[model samples]
Target: MRDSLSLWFIVKNYRIRSVFIKNFFIILSLILLPVTGFSVGIYQLYSKTVTEEISSAHLHSLSRIRDMIDMTIREADNYSIRIASSETLATLMSPSPMHNYDLNVNVLKMSAELNMMDTMRNFVESVYVYSEQNRSVISSQMGRWDLEQFLDQGWLDSYNTNKSQRKAWTVARKAKTFQSESEEKTLITLFRLAPLLETSKLGSVIINIDTARFMNMINQTGSDYIDSVFIIGGDGTILGSNDLTLINRPISDVIPVKDIAEGKPNEPVFVYEDESKQSVSYVHSLYNDWKFVSIAPLKLYEDKAKYIRNYLYISSLFSIVVALIISLVVSWRMYMPIKQIMSVVSRPGEWLEESPPPKRVNEIKYITSSILDSYGEKRELENELRYRLSLLDRAYAIALQSQINPHFLYNTLETINWQAIRLSGGENVVSDMISSLSQLLRFSLEGEDNLVPIRVEIEHCKHYIDIQKIRYPRKVDVQWHLDEKIMNYKIPRITLQPLIENSIYHGIRPMSQEGMITISGQLEGDSIVIRVADNGVGADPDKIERINQELADKNWITANNHIGIRNVNQRIKLTFGDQYGLHMASVPGHGTTVTVRISAIQA
Candidate 1:
């Protein structure tokens, strides 16, 4: 009989161990998996958000640079028009009807006046008159020159043929005085007819412009980001440039000919890579068919974006690592008492049952003596009742662990309130936070039922949703569906709040686009099922499986936020037996859903 009793005792202890292991696994799944997932998700989200912001800023900078180039080209075109329409040129070409004697004296005086006007203009490098009759060139600087040896037939033909048509022609060539081998140095000349009279055709006006001076004016109006600007003629010849060395080179040799040819009439052409393989060029063509090109190195802008991305990644990674370390340390500290209790419970069955009862201290003896004197024989019985009541109260209190510290909650709410006031008071976020806080606090402090009415649970969820909505207004959406018959059923207080908080803070917050959180409850057979789902970053299968394994092994207490699901599970098992509890299912990108099962309570 004694052997049989011992066998029975061993079996009972083994059964208890099995139950503890099962409970451990269930609790682990509810807590650790969500915490780890939340941390990683938030980190990735922060990284992506910072990356997109930097990219947008880079694009804006590129657009501004393009606008600056356009403005510079426009300014250059206006200057060209001004020189073409100068009143001095018109006066010099006016008709002299009489074939007068003293023609040299009159012509000399007119030439001197024209020279003086050219000096005052500053932009004109040289002003000359070409006489077709004498084949002589007279200039302000070069006094007299015979055009026979110096003027090319191509230039003379273009000038003589187009003179009657009154069409101006421009040409780019090495400056007549150039002494250097530098490729960029060159000169541009504008040629037009100066009709001496209606009856007599004598000569034309030739204007030579200093290309460097023209480029300087263009450069002054352009952005500092431009490395160089080019002035290319219609025939793909480099007329002038900010870079002097490129002045006389053919455009086809320096830039791709296809690019300039294929470019739109007025629209700028953006080439990603140039001859140097380092810069990007934006090219625009003037009405005169000269190409205005701005070259800026791509490295200048790309470096900025790269720096920002690197800095953001490093900072986010460091922050997450530090936060995780701190959380682990703090959680371990907070979990000490519960860990001690678990350790005591996990000891060998024989050792626990054989342990001596705690000895009464001097204070307890004195309290007992006082009670005995005051109540006589009834003191012993009343003392036992008081002890049992105290034990019951302690056990019940352990069922609910406040989601956030009271001080933290109050401070956060206070901050939200002030921010809401500043945000122009219209259904402001602070009001929502305060309402959520009030509901959460009321449920924590006054809803003493192990199973609260379903209506109260729904209100708690709504309040939590309101606070999250305020924090992430554009990112999180909440939906609620409830069955009328399940309204009166009771649930453990503070049970669903953590799940909702996890959904918002971990799930919805990580998504770049807006996300939704759903809370739905319905009656199915004899049980009511409540589901909270979020269209957020969902759980990893490997992690979920690992957490399940940890739960099965009763190692979940080693994980983060030990009190959340474990405490709720314990309360449910103690109040309504082991059949009712929480269940979770998830898929990546799609979302996570948590379901709580409870027996429907009759009104």
Candidate 2:
């Protein structure tokens, strides 16, 4: 018994230790995959990936911030438009009060007019209506008053200055005492003229949004990656910011906005820096003529990735520890079965060699009884594997057959193409059709791979367009706006053919006179967007919207009608992620534009 125990410890214990060490090494190697791929020798490539991801995240957050700002500005503009267009406000703001006896009625009417802005639920610090003719201010806090005491000289100079546009966006400042300290809050004011039919000078309306409240809204909407948010003018005049010190200061030329006015409106300007340096991203608001700048240290941009990396490291460590324990357990379990066989081997040789009945004990019986039918069982497994391979091969062959059938058409077309060359010197109509048909077929069924170069897809489209132009030679004209730089980027095969086909069939052919189909490609942000537009009788707005909805959902129930477009949309999504796909914008009488969105990436 002591001998058996000693042997068990010596043999089984060593096996457990050996297996544990081997498995731990394997697991540690596997845990280091992310590190080897990006963390170690490929540090520069990993940095670029991290930077792009961070920039994209910042851009997305900036979009949301822009939306919130646009919405806020729109609400203010709407309020001004509403007040300007109102007949009641026009009557109240006239050169003279309309009624002298109806003082109470006028008060009630003005009070009710003031209360209209309250219902909007926006963060309005105060509302004021100032009459420039009389130099009088009618505020929500203080009713109608004919005085210049409400505003300081500096405040009045900025407001009356010709700097801001029709919608004057004033920097937040502590104006002189108007009504009370209760009404005072460091505020940015928006000024709009009360709309009138005649050229008679009336007053302007002032809507103030608290600087703190505005910045709070900005902070809440902005992602953690945005370290600072700024609302500045074209000349770098700081209109608003979370930091009060930055609020009135001139923007440093280091973060330039001088050429922002020259830049096309709505385009974002981005500046990036190293890990220790600050990065700045800004967008110009066409409505208010103010640019919003979001600045952050580069490390903040990678903070989320840093957290994820740390988490992965901790998880790998924990997994390696757990794998060590599991390997020991598994090694011990395996040894039990082997130990039973070893016992049989050590027993009397003649009895062991006998073909014996199974023992009742599970470990001994399980080890001994399975050996007799091992060859038959191996044969059965081999047959099952063969059956599976046969089915897979047949399925693969059927798929190849489907793709191969298109080649038969290509072969016949090639023969006709050669015959056309013999008949008409390869320049006649049939020759063109055969050549186009062959190219189209090859493009459509070239290989199992879905992606092809943009140049190839463009050529495929041009070939299809050539066939269409021949069918209606007098009416159709094609213009190419291919960007040479993006031609090598891979797009799903035959992507533009369906779009061009739709433009020809549904769009151009429907129009009466000569129609033009324009195909354009350009880099819009990080995406390579290709647009197909036709000056044809466009589809009804309702139908266009329905088609767009269907494309978005990829719910192609009827394969017969929109199969080509459906396939293109699905292929675009499959090749690039779900965020990239087809979009449609159309005008009822003018034309329809189909947009194909693909991520611009190297093959």
Model-by-model lDDT, in order?
A: 0.59, 0.69
Provide C-alpha RMSD values for all models, in order: 37.8, 45.5
Q: What tens-digit string does per-residue lDDT give for candidate 1 at 539-568?
A: 998866664444333212323464465555
TM per prediction = 0.37, 0.40
Candidate 2 lDDT for residue 62:
71
Clashes of 1: 9
**Model 1 CA deviation exceeding 4 Å by range:** 1-101, 116-120, 149-166, 177-185, 196-203, 248-252, 255-261, 264-287, 297-310, 323-603
Most accurate candidate by lDDT? 2
- Candidate 2: where is the Cα deviation over 4 Å? 1-41, 97-99, 118-122, 149-155, 163-172, 176-184, 253-275, 300-603
How far is 214's C-alpha from truth in model 1 (Å)? 2.8
lDDT of 2 by residue, 283-358 (tens): 7674666777777566754675577667666766776676566655665565556655555444423334565766
Compute the lDDT of residue 255 as modeled in candidate 1: 63
